[model samples]
Target chain A: MTGETVMFWVLAPLTVFAAVGMLLVKKAVHSAILLAFVMIALAIFYIAQDAPFLGIVQIVVYTGAVMMLFLFILMLVGVDSSDSLVETIKGLRGVAITTSLAFAAALTSLIARAEFGQEPLGLVSANANGNVEGIANLIFRQYVWAFEVISALLITAALGAMVLAHSPKSSEARLSQRARSVARFRGASIGTAAGLPGSGVFARHNAVDVPALLPDGKPSDLSISSVLAERGDVQETKRYALDGLPKLDEEDK
Target chain B: MTEYASLLLDDPIWLVAVKALLIFVLCVLLTLLAIWGERRIVARMQLRVGPNRVGPFGLVQGLADGVKLALKEDLIPKAADKVIFIIAPIISASTCFLAFAVIPMTGKVLFFGEETVFQLTDLSVGVLYILAAASVGVYGIVLAGWSSGSTYPLLGGLRSSAQVISYEIAMGLSFVAVFMYAGSMSTSEIVDSQAQWWNVVVLFPSFVIYVISMIGETNRAPFDLAEAEGELVGGFHTEYSSLKFALFFLAEYVNIMAVSALATTLFLGGPAAPPGLSFTESWLGGWFTFIWFILKVALFFFLFVWLRGTLPRLRYDQFMKFGWKVLIPVNIAWILIVATLRLMTQEGASQFMLAGFIITVVVLVMLATTIYESSKAKAEAAARFVPEMPEPSFPVPELPKQKRVEL
Candidate 1:
């Protein structure tokens, strides 16, 4: 087989495997990353097919921008928050499975009916006048209206996102309340700061920026979620404890 | 000499491999040289004696550093996702190298008694390919940061990805003018189009925008908030050590070189000689064109170092605001103006009509900008009015005055 064919065989399976992995992964972050792999594989397939412009666009727009956004949100939200198994909508799973299977069957049938060996219709070869030009010619000359409509749809989506994200009045009220609290804090005496300091036996660290260290030299707070802590997700050792060495077993003694 | 050189047209597989290998080596060497050059230049600017121990004037300091990195013990944070953590640097380094494939290093040159181009490979969508590689490079950083299972690294990765995406839009828009004028996305064709005059001379606005966006795109100083030492520690690679850390560092320098090479290819005219230098053609032969390309790239590298030494990092919010609110809008406006001008010229419109159209567009744009600025000022004035709140009273302690002493 030619190198291109070899590449296709390798990438196609990898893409499918990654897509499956994305669904199977319990961690949302892992799923997002797997999706990126799938995207990159698809981009390579586009390049193998000589659709250089499309391939690059796939990487740039989907794998790069979209997947990064997904990963960013996933990281910010933390990884301990797994999706609940409880179904919010009754019978939704059954409905989803049925629709998915029907769609799959229809797509398979369509693909089986298509003539794979024939030259593509209404599309110039990528190398003829260069891929960019060929694509541009089609978009501008033939599919101009569709292109403009898609762009309009995109703009509308952006506007909708802005409207959804905006909450000006509530935000302003929250900001004012925060300002009032800051003002109140500024007026309070040093001793009254942090709302009645811990008892002398449990004195907190004086520095505001650093995490408070307990008297025994352990960090007072863990930044990770409680769920993660319960699952033993904390990797770094809390402290070096010389006294915590295991006592001799009773049987051995 | 050929006006333009096409790439990978029926070349043997062995020849293609050789070209790829050559470009890879060249990029690696350039990155190392750039590192040493940056340190020396920045030191000179700061009036200090830089590294001089490794080789004459510290030329081999980068190599020494590389060896040290290789010998050092590799450390992976226990919390890290092992698979993604390992692949992150590989992705970064590979993508950085990939961008060079489309950069035209020289026009046709004699190689084994056959005419060949001095580029690894070129695609019809050459500029887009470079852009794609750059975009993909962001994944390396983001994944590294996320897989580290650390807060700062995650933040850094997110910032870097956002910064790249925002600036890329402006960068792509800036290229619209160049593409319109050159009539091709192929690097060699763009270079050939600039034989008479460089794009920087005629398309000054696009040139300026591209330079600014390129700086942002590469995460260089004034736009390097992603890895800001004061805020994010080592940023996305905070947990990486040894060869992995070295790979991240290598990727950064390689990215700088790739971006500089791209800037050279796009605006400065890839491997073409400067307009007034006829002596190069007669005395130095056509191969001397590569020198011109390297010199242009080096100039950009110098600019990067200069900015790093001079400027303070911008605040993250302000950086984002400037990118999304200012650069992108300005780039779009500029593209529209350029498109109209190209259309007018292509239509062979009369000089009067062309001038009239230009004036009308400029006036309308100015009017719109002025109105927007006025409204923005008004909004700022309104938002500055914070509601006054009564001050709370608190008891204070007094200290006794100390005894006075003679000065």
Candidate 2:
């Protein structure tokens, strides 16, 4: 194998492996990180192809932008421990393994039929790396339609992503909230005592610690600060959360 | 390709690696300096010293601050996802640093006996590489925000991801015009093809689009919603402390410098002297080429600084609308115009006829733009003149109320 070919074969499998691993990863955030490794490897592949621009674009766009979006979303939604791959595929393991093997077999056949070129193509050697002048001629005349098609695809994808990113949290909460919110009053019984601040996650979801309505239905603006202050003040805040979890354990046992 | 004895040996892998390392270091240094320069320049524009003390000329101030950040206890919020919290910044910093490998700073230079291109590598799909790199860079911000396991950071990351995506399309389209005009996407080839007229001149519309898109892509001022200092409170990096925060900052500034360098290369001509000087045979010509490159890059850098100082950040909605409604569509129309020009040239159409067609297209575009601007302005004025709506007792959240809890 040529140095270029050697570089590519080694890197390409790693890239594909990482990308597949990203798909298989349980934690959404971890999946995003795996996707980044795949993206970086793909960029190296682009560099090997003598397409530095595309490699940079791959890194900048897929690794930087798209994966970041995925990560942000995972973060935004709160880590979905429920979506853990192992957990998701618990019952489907046998079928999944069979399907994956079938897919791999088909892929191998396709690769086996591909023709090999005798020599490595280089921007320097061939001056035929067929860059600006070559692409200009080809794009203007031959591949113009393909170019426009890609642009259209990009436009739709951009809009779709934006819409998805901005999706409201309403349906998620209303539909799945009760099942998932678990509020961990789980099969594990909770103490009847409710006044201890961090009995549950202690409002990890919201930072907006405003006042509540009094029993008399009067506004209690004064209590907002007082309540919030007491939650943290002379009494150390960290202990409440640490202390809260064990209390549930005690009640359950 | 002629193999360089200096570079081909095992020792030189380390050497090239060292050089690459130096370039990365220089880029980060430049970014910090640019940040300081931007502040000081803006302060001068507004009549103030940006960051005096810490060191003379505040020269050492950026460095001093960097050292201070390093010395400070690296605080990992107890709530943050520990592994990702560490990895995200590395991704951002490394990707930004890697982008420089392809940018031709001073064109070809002698190394040992062989002629060597100043670029780290060339690729037929070079432009696409850049786009991909930038896309990956966003992950760092988004992941950092998400892994922080904090509300604000998550929100900031989400917003940033959206912002980058929205602008990236326009940025890609902007490059299409360059690709069309130059014919190749290779950095060196594109630079070479602009032997006569820098694509900036021939493809001025594309140049304008690229300039706008580059700013938006880099998340510069007026478009920096990802880390909106005012609202998100340092945005994605809000949960970060010490070296983590510095990495994010370094990535931001380094990316800024990379994009500026890219703009200078693509539009202004990479490392080549300006048209007149490159062609001139004087010993001064070669010397001047390096000088011209730095000058051009500096100018573009200054523009970034100026925009940060002058423009207030756009509202998130308006920013997206501008990208989708204005920039993308306008780029499409401009591409059509460029396509027509390319067709005419290919068909061996008469120069006069082509010129007339071009003139007509230019006039129509300008007229349309003017009419659109007037209508937009008129709408703005009419809205302002109309009575403001009474404050609602409870302003409806833009997001669905059900989301209020999940969010």
Candidate of highest TM-score: 1
DockQ of each: 0.19, 0.16
Point to the candidate with the largest DockQ.
1
Tell me the tens digit of each residue's lDDT in model 2 across B92-159: 88878767876766554444433454456655666666777677677687778777887788888888
How far residue A26's Cα lies from its native spot in candidate 1, in Å, is 3.8
lDDT of 2 by residue, A19-48 (tens): 888778677767767777877787777666
Error of 1 at B307 (Å): 0.5
TM-score, candidate number 2: 0.70
Query: What TM-score, computed on C-alpha atoms, does each candidate reach?
Result: 0.82, 0.70
Q: Please give, for residues B1-407, the per-residue lDDT of candidate 1 as tens digits.
A: 12444335756777878888888899889988988999999999999978888988899999999999999999988888899899999999999998888788876676555567778776777898888888888889888988898789988888887898899989988898999999887787788788888999989999998999899998889899998999999888888999999999999999999889988998998877788884674344467878888999999999999999999899999988988898888888888888888998899989998999889987998899899999998766655545455555433322234334689
What does DockQ come to for candidate 1?
A: 0.19
Location of the lowest summed lDDT over 10 successive residues in candidate 1 chain A? A197-206
Give me the runs in candidate 1 sitting further than 4 Å from their true place.
A80-90, A108-128, A170-253, B1-3, B7-10, B372-407
| CA lDDT, candidate 1, residue B149 | 82
